[model samples]
Target chain A: MFNKDNQLEKFKDAETIIGASIKVKGNFQGQGSIIIEGSLEGSLKTDANLFIGDRAKVTANIESKDAIVNGEVRGNIKSKNYLAIGGTAKIFGDIQYGEISVAKGAIINGQLMMLSEEHKRNDKLKPEEKAVATDK
Target chain B: MHVYIYDDYLNKSKYNKTINRIEIRLTDLGLNGKIIRLGGIKNIKGTIQNEIKLGAKTIVAVGNNQTINKIIGAVIDTDIYSDFQKKTILGIIPVGGDNSIAASFGIKNEEEACNILLARRVEKIDLGIVGQYYFLNQATIQSLGTILEIDDYSLEIIKRGEVSIINLLSDKNQSIKSNPHDGKLDIYIKTKRKDQTYLSAKKLLITNPNNKLLVDGVIEMATPIEVGISKDRVNVIVGKDRMFE
Candidate 1:
């Protein structure tokens, strides 16, 4: 069997592009992995990985399953499992996640919070509540 | 039906051509009978309000993002939000360096956008309310926010006008932390580090544990923030094939 972290395995998933010099102003909701290379002026919600490139300038509240930012973000960010910030990142927002990684030089002038068991349990309750509403 | 054109794009000739082309296409569609030409700012300084008051049905924005912004501002300034919404359908021509909001909504070119507008199926899109302005895109703050204010002169001087977001922060970056404007906002901190590669490279797992920080782009606030989704704020004319997905 091949190693998962190997270079060949890395190519199996190519990052999707939002393109450079582009500007978006809306509610950005999606699934699957996405990489922002341009400017985003809105909110982002996703169930998959989201990567903000160093060249990107994002001004949106982001929610994702996993997120790695190496650019400039001016909003709150949320991830369930992982959130990594590169040295080049200039972020001014809040974040919530289970795991966090910050390189030497990353700039974040917001809040950070790790979800406690109670909070995660509450997060679970939200969907159940939604389900009950939909049932009715 | 009057069409007011605004040309504030970097390329003036291209925008003009798009306008002429649109006029030609409308004429071809036998809409010449309803087409009325007006000066770019003829409706400005209190005239558009009169037309809108008379119940204008369609407002076509023929320039770039700023043109759309100006129209939105005028409508809001005139205290005609509901009136504009009830009687108006906005049509945008993506004429600028980057039309992110337009692109995200699947508005590709001037021709396709015009076709959709003429076809007329109103789709209510969300808008982002930042400060006093209602924007259709995301509002940025902090480092990215500061960069937006960089003057054009500085931009031109720094490598013949080729500047990226990261390049602007290189010289002046510091361990500057911002104080929370309101107690409700989560204050996240990423203490300055010196590593070349990211923490993802080291295979060392780090967890925020506090549930109070906004990491990477994740926000966890104990109290409600001023920011949230605003629904059905702007009316758009989208094609039938366009997918909301």
Candidate 2:
């Protein structure tokens, strides 16, 4: 079993928290980390990592350095470093990531593309660490 | 010079004991200055402005939130707001009920409040401005049929919700804190579907037909209101337990 706490502990430092009762509609651009537990309808771009809670319903194109999603998303997602789709996630958009993890029971209905980088950077990623999906 | 403005309500005999104690403490610390009684004054704003012009460096509110609210309302409206932004400071000595504003400053009781004043640790804090009113806390606007126009985008709430633009929270909730030092204001929306939305904006425009923006749970004004930060931040004496650094 994945240690959910270990996966989410880092986001506790997240400066922006969208609580479960809020529904926002706007292009959100921020430098600080963000955690979404509510609904977003526009676009999201951030320099730091992003976390989507299990019950979050997002309809925004998301761009982040790192992302972990365990909710329902309906737009495209691009992560420069890493992307993790949890078991309960339901995604219906294209994805771009340097490294990716999709746990069992997660649903995706879009194409996935690996971000292009130098060969030395790609070589640093072990064979066991690239596209580590439980079942795709 | 420090000027202590005591709220009119504090004039009631019920509060005589606390008032006497506070006066003694202020005198003991050699921090006492001119005292203004609000009950006898007709034009509070003028009184505050007059004190400012006469070289009162520190303005202290000696009652609850309502007391500080009135004093702040007066202070921000004066011309001195722009000229001496840092030279003048606001202090709070929470005397009676509804003093969450003081607690947020890390001040607990009147005794500690005096000590905090003596220490004179100051911080620049933001305030939410709407027309003639300035709020230290948050502004609540009814979500129904409200359109919030931010810089690059607009937001509309289809579902029932409460929209608040927060400079700082009134209560001390460790769960989440809205930083008063941040130049941006936090936009919070709570909907009926158990959905919550949180974002921050530097400035925004609120358009609501026949609705008003309730500022700091005090003043009410009609909408198409432009809400933004005060052009100049106010210096406030704060304690270590202040909600924001």
Candidate 3:
């Protein structure tokens, strides 16, 4: 959905969707945003956003640029950018995020760590640092 | 060094002027090649084989999407094409119907196609393969009770709609980075609901007998088919503003 300033973020156009009836059990890594509405038992990693639908059940550690969770997650979540925990979300793992927004009814059973500004900046510069180190 | 394969439909009386204009443009651009009018769709592979044997380095398909797929199929079948892989390049001069493939390559018309051929800017692109057939664009299956298996993921559809395995993003305005050179196919399964979604992977296996598999808008095969990417498969001449990038 394109609005003024083009800042609208919707997972409607997600490149990958894990439907409600399917179950995945492997290390899932890819380039594009992924939507999960089913069951997953793997380490999920992506440089794009991750959307967990309300009916979804995920049992994996999620590493993503951004994430919006409304389902059940049994592992740690590391959002490099923004993480939104919806009202229906039942998260049972430690959370680490650059920026976080949690709804009233969301349940988090583990510690929540707001990433420090210095850490965020360092995370942003890791690629450039690696490039520089490689040049040496 | 170019061999032009014109579709048989161009031989109709109404297309004489259009063909003449194309030929004149080709001559004016100093990019004239051996022109072969296809007698029928069945003879396309054999005609291409004859032209390849005649030492044609570039095979320019002058027709719509179906004609392009036929030429592509001939080129990829090593048993028939006989080792013309890296040596031969494909070009398109869109003549009729929905020529999305030509538009994707940034060739608008006959003159632009000739210009691209003259420029000789060849890009090695990936192609979607279903059995022995090679498709330049996406392939689709429209039916209910279908299951799509890609890599380690499997999606079962109970409602009827369409499942598209996209190789190159046809819509220019589409923001997704679905590239033909990326060696990955974008699988989009659109059902009736607005909420149901799917993902992408390599080596797709669609299991169902109730649907027809359409490659580039033409019904080529049935369901229960396997789709995979053939990487760096074809060298194709593309316009300066080619869409695949």
Candidate 4:
């Protein structure tokens, strides 16, 4: 019984934290949650949640279980579970999410799509069926 | 069984007492194995190959992290032992300077290590591979401002410091809870500028011009390295309070 606020709070104990002054350019994939307060330019995918701090500037495609963004992102974002755009957030890319919440002052300049039920159902199927559907 | 003793520590006159104690403990534990004193770094591969040819099922390293690192390098480079590498069990005694690997397995001293060997409890652990080398603990680079790549993402370090790829999470200050068996490498970047430091990734590729890479705090190698998890590559004797458990 955890709300979005509670879930976001859980990321405070992130295993990886990119500091405000650092700049990273690479592909990052992991099982643990990560918090970013710096600048990153690449792709990021994790089995856990991702927390982007207000001072952060990320120019990378992001895929994660959940995401809470309070920064500036210039790339696509796809969250499997939930996506929260904070008050200070400024995003300029398409967003694909299962569920999402946006703060009143947040700015987004691209498409936002809640994952379709058929897409969700397709996601649950095995790789072979998904491949067959793609062929069709 | 074969025991490869790193003679650098054992040959020292100061450690006669410790060496004697380890010898006595090994004998008392009823573990019969051919003990080979490693002569130099160059001879490591040949020694391991010879032992494996002589039907060695278990190879014990009777020194610190350096000794284990050498054995891992030898086992990985030698083709004769490749097929049987996973089957071969590696043991540690922790008699040298940095015994963090042994310490991670709940083995603080030589006596406890011998006892664990007698208990015969083995854990198949994961190894971090950097090109041809296999490391059990972690690999690090000091000079920063290098671009680290992991899959499709890249992390560019802005400052000068150390960037480490950790395999087995040790007692060292690590925010990430990394398990050696978890088919993932923990990447930690620490910079010289105090507030500017801090970054972690699961896996990364080192594409920098830095020449030196330290593995397990020992074994320095040239870079342009690819780091990843080699699943269940090594079997080691561990105590009941081992790290993974």
- RMSD, each candidate, Å? 15.4, 6.4, 5.2, 4.1
DockQ versus reference, model 3: 0.31
True contacts kept of each: 0.00, 0.48, 0.42, 0.71
What Cα-based lDDT does every candidate model obtain? 0.52, 0.82, 0.79, 0.76
Model 4 agreement with the true structure over B1-245: per-residue lDDT tens digits: 65545556677788788878988888888875787777544576787777777777778888888777777777664586565465577888888678888888878888888888888798888888777667788888874656776556566776677777877866745544567876767676766444333444445677667557777776777767777777787778887766666
Best by lDDT: 2
| Candidate 4 per-residue lDDT over residues A100-123, each given as its tens digit | 989899999999999987776676
Model 4 chain B lDDT-worst window of ten: B193-202
Task: Report DockQ per prediction, comma-separated.
Answer: 0.05, 0.31, 0.31, 0.50
Per-residue accuracy of model 2 over B72-187 as CA lDDT, tens digit each? 77767567665447567899999877887888789999999999999999988888888767788889988877788887667666656688898877666424568888787888
- TM-score per model (chain B): 0.57, 0.90, 0.88, 0.82
Under CAPRI classification, how is model 2 graded? Answer: acceptable
Candidates sorted by TM-score, descending order?
2, 4, 3, 1
Pull out the clashing pairs in model 2. A20-B195, A20-B196, A21-B195, A21-B196, A22-B195, A22-B196, A22-B197, A23-B197
Candidate 3 residue pairs in backbone clash: A16-B199, A17-B198
Count residue pairs with overlapping backbones in model 3.
2
Better-scoring candidate (DockQ), 1 or 4: 4
Q: Model 4: residues >4 Å from true position, as ranges?
A: A1-5, A9-34, A42-48, A60-65, A75-81, A93-99, A108-136, B1-6, B39-48, B82-88, B192-204
Residue B62 in candidate 4 has what lDDT?
A: 87
If the candidates were sorted by their lDDT against the true structure, best first, what order would they fall in? 2, 3, 4, 1
CAPRI grade of model 3:
acceptable
Stretch of 10 with least lDDT, candidate 3 chain A = A1-10
Worst 10 residues of 4 chain A by lDDT: A1-10
Report the C-alpha displacement of residue B214, candidate 2, in angstroms: 2.2
